[model samples]
Target: MTAAARLLDDVCHLTAQSLNRLETSEHFRVVKMLGEGSYGKVVLAVHNQSASASVCPGSPMALKFFPRATTSLCSFLREYNLSLRFCTHPSLSRALGIAYLTPSHYVFAQQAGLFGDLYDFIVPEAGVEEDRCQRVVSQLSGALSHLHSLGFVHRDVKPENVFLCDAACRWVKLGDFGMAKARGTKVPEVWYRSPYCTPEAETARGDGDGAGERSEPEEKKRGPRVWASVEPSVDSWALGVLTYAMLTGAHPWPQTSSDCGAYLKYLHWFRTAKSPEEELDLWAEPQHQGPDGTPADFGAKEQPSVAPQFARFTPLGRAFFRLLLNPGPADRGRPEDALGYLGGAWVPVGERERLEERRKKSRGGGGGGAVNEVKLKDGRGLR
Candidate 1:
């Protein structure tokens, strides 16, 4: 049997056992739909277990449901297993349970985020706070380190895949491992991939140029194929992209009519650039004119410019971006390197102390009793 077929068989056997255990488990209930994607639909749920009763009315949970026809059973099983393995980490989302609801469908459950995904937190005028952004990068770096240590690569690492555990945006967790795979595996031909894909992935897929146009000799001379075997470095590349997006309300590439257009431009630039620094310089440079002979900055008034945000980054931050964004997998920075560069503290000790103090003050009904909620551009809570 094929690997996928074997995995599916194992999943079926495991699901059958889980179903038997779930018969007496009547505490879990779906609350509302959280979001939907090509993989499946995610919903907010509550488990009325006695252990969690003291904390809140219902123990909040996030449940992902995949229709057997629409989603690959093997992919679902992969994510379920990975999440369960890494869930103990503070920065990694935990898998609560998994079950096959019917022969045609399956469901996976986990702890729900109070705020939501990172995309919901992004706004036009103002982006996430600098401290919060640093915290997120640090936390995610730790999470990536853990995953890399296990010899896995989270192929998809974008804003939408990251979840915030609290309203304050103090704790962030990496989620959605459906696209994850073992290191050195052949990259899958996923149609609906994140725009934050690395240069290697783009090149391997022949993203910018027509696939048939490139000859094998030219490809060989150019070094590895763009869609080279998947590596842990792809996650690092995505971390750089995600950091830029969070700091600025824009992508690192020039604005395009569609995400695909921008992604193509990103790939083309990376393909031609001599180094990661050169690629970053290209993104930092302002566009001059378009084919219509009109200034490309016409829409400046509508959206916040990424240039200013890029300017605000510290020297260490800029270096970190360049390191992770390197086109070559070998040159790319590891998660541990990022953690060290961000200050050898996985969760900064001082920050934790401050947060604890705030919580204590709130509990005592002090003047500063409100939770330090992170606000969106419109001055609304991230929730």
Candidate 2:
């Protein structure tokens, strides 16, 4: 059987068994289910049973089940692998490990962050502010900068993938790296709020002054395809949409319930706003006429302007939307450059140090808090 097929069979067989009974590690105990998504199921588990003999250190953890046949398996594995690649970042979630129950079936484990996702937090019910929104955006952009510099693209940059844990979530943690693609490779997943889609270039040439007809491939292979394919800028585009939602609590473009309607709008945005270079010029020369030959408007009383939508943002925020979301890849700011614009101003070392310091204090108190107390007869007891 193919790898995918074999994996599906293994998943079917293993899922039939009592998954709750499976012991991934000696330190944690299976508690109960937490939530389920398109990717898989998340279970709330704790280390209550292993305080005496547990070698693992955390108090409680989350267990994520990734079925082989489901799209979530690939996404889970992708997150597991990429998380390892950028394991040390404080703003990024720590991936514990992966457990392959069967040849094809597996579970990804990680240290759980406190809040669920930004989407649940930033809705009309939550009622956040502009400065707070800017802080979270800065943290995410910083994290994205790190990821992009490491040659990875987070194809999915929606609020659902960003976790907010600490007070006010002045601190931010990025989750769900399943749709991320390597820097140079093309990913095929659909994006909902990305302003920058991949650009497809069509070089048009014809006879000019007796010159022979010449043509070039509109789609370039080495770099980003301008119109047809979505590139890394899609992340920036999504960030813009996110910023808009965070500030105004509404979508930049019209939102629809039907998948078809939503997609039509998405495509329209993709085709119309495919070039970032042009967008930058719009801000640079507001008084100049556009290529379609119409004067750009910045002072229209009824319409929103870049200056105002970006008023509450820092210099970095303005640059992020302008350059990072440049409709074209060439115009869009390089992830590193965009991050450099952020500089050291928005360092994201929120409560991690405080929490760790507290843990040390607690452990220093000589309570039986050290998780390594279980004296295995041998150095290694269970494999």
Candidate 3:
């Protein structure tokens, strides 16, 4: 067997042994199903007793159950280990504990996100507020920076993976590390990745078939070969795509066939000599040509607004997006760069001015207004 196959075999054996021990322990009780995915089911859970007596009991948590039949042991271990390593960060989800439930099952308990994911929170009619968008992206940058500092890159970063702590979305955290990989490592061919993939990743096709589709030798089908170099910039690229989605209610690239067609369009745009802003503006136009010479109306339900919402972004905000969305991976902004931009005057002036005005009113005994501040449970402030 190859090295990776051997390692997977070892993990499977160890997992079986761990589950045997956990079957005798009684530390958690399942409440109800929270969500279900292709590989596993997540459920609301409560700790019966703290992992230690010094800690409190009855704390609510989320238990993600992975069945051996559908989920790979290697991916589960990667997420579990990474979660434990970076849980201290307020913007990253905390993995409280892990336990084996059965020979074919394992469970990981993590901090529950009260509000749903960013994908659900966004609305087409009204895109996310500029201030709120800045806050979410800022926290995500911090999380990505922390992850990079730990020598890892989140291969998948999208709205579905971003979670809110409250209904107001004042505190946001990045979760779901199943696709994360170590920096400088060879990109795994068999990995499951989000559609909001980086250009580098999309272009690194094994067989030159097309972007986003896997091409490998028949013998390598099981484990899949690693063909591309992994880097921290992949995460940055995904963040750029996410930023565009949040600012505008639609995707930056065309959403034609719901397959790799959009990625192909992105590739074409990247090769074009046109400016980034001009390329982005093309999304506002109807892509699908009609049978006649005129532009085809995809119908009111299918068509996004012709006017690009990104025009509303402040000058600095536009610059920030450009920095992140640079077609060249080496040219993309690092997490620290994003943080600096966010802390600087790149954000909308109204947001900072409004916060300052709110502080003044509170100091003058006018009482605090409806101004919202993003703070973590540990008392650390995001902004």
Instruction: Write model 3 residue lDDT over 89-187, tens digit each, in one string.
Output: 799987774555566676777888867678665543234555677788888988998878777788768776788898566799898887777677764
Best by TM-score: 3
Window of ten residues with lowest summed lDDT in model 1: 369-378
Compose the digit string of candidate 2's lDDT tens values, residues 1-383.
Answer: 22433443455454435333344646457676756765677776765443233225545666767667754444545566566446456677666543444444467566676666676544331124445676776788778877766666676676656676764878888877766665556323222212222222211111121122224542232233222333557577667666655644444333211233543444454354424344434346335533322333423421233333333332233445566545455656654455444332211122223333543554466432112221221111100
Ranking by lDDT: 3, 1, 2
TM-score of each: 0.64, 0.56, 0.66
Off by over 4 Å in 3: 1-27, 53-55, 189-195, 204-226, 255-312, 343-383
Instruction: List the candidate 1 regions with Cα displacement exceeding 4 Å.
Output: 1-27, 48-57, 189-195, 205-227, 254-312, 343-383
TM-score of 3: 0.66
Candidate 3 overall Cα lDDT vs. reference? Answer: 0.60
Q: Each candidate: RMSD to true structure?
A: 12.2, 16.7, 12.3
- Ranking 2 against 3 by lDDT, winner: 3
Q: Compute the lDDT of residue 313 as modeled in candidate 1.
A: 43
- Candidate 1 local lDDT, 1-383, one digit each (tens): 23543453466457546552242137567777887765668888776663432234477778777777876656666677668655567989887754446555677777678688887765432345556777888899888987777667787777677898885678989988876776777743322233354554543343333223447787576555444466888788778877776655455653211345654544454454334344335346455743433235534531132233232343345556667776567878887777655552212233334434544444465332111233321122221
CA lDDT, every prediction? 0.59, 0.49, 0.60
> Which window of ten consecutive residues has the lowest lDDT sum in model 2?
374-383
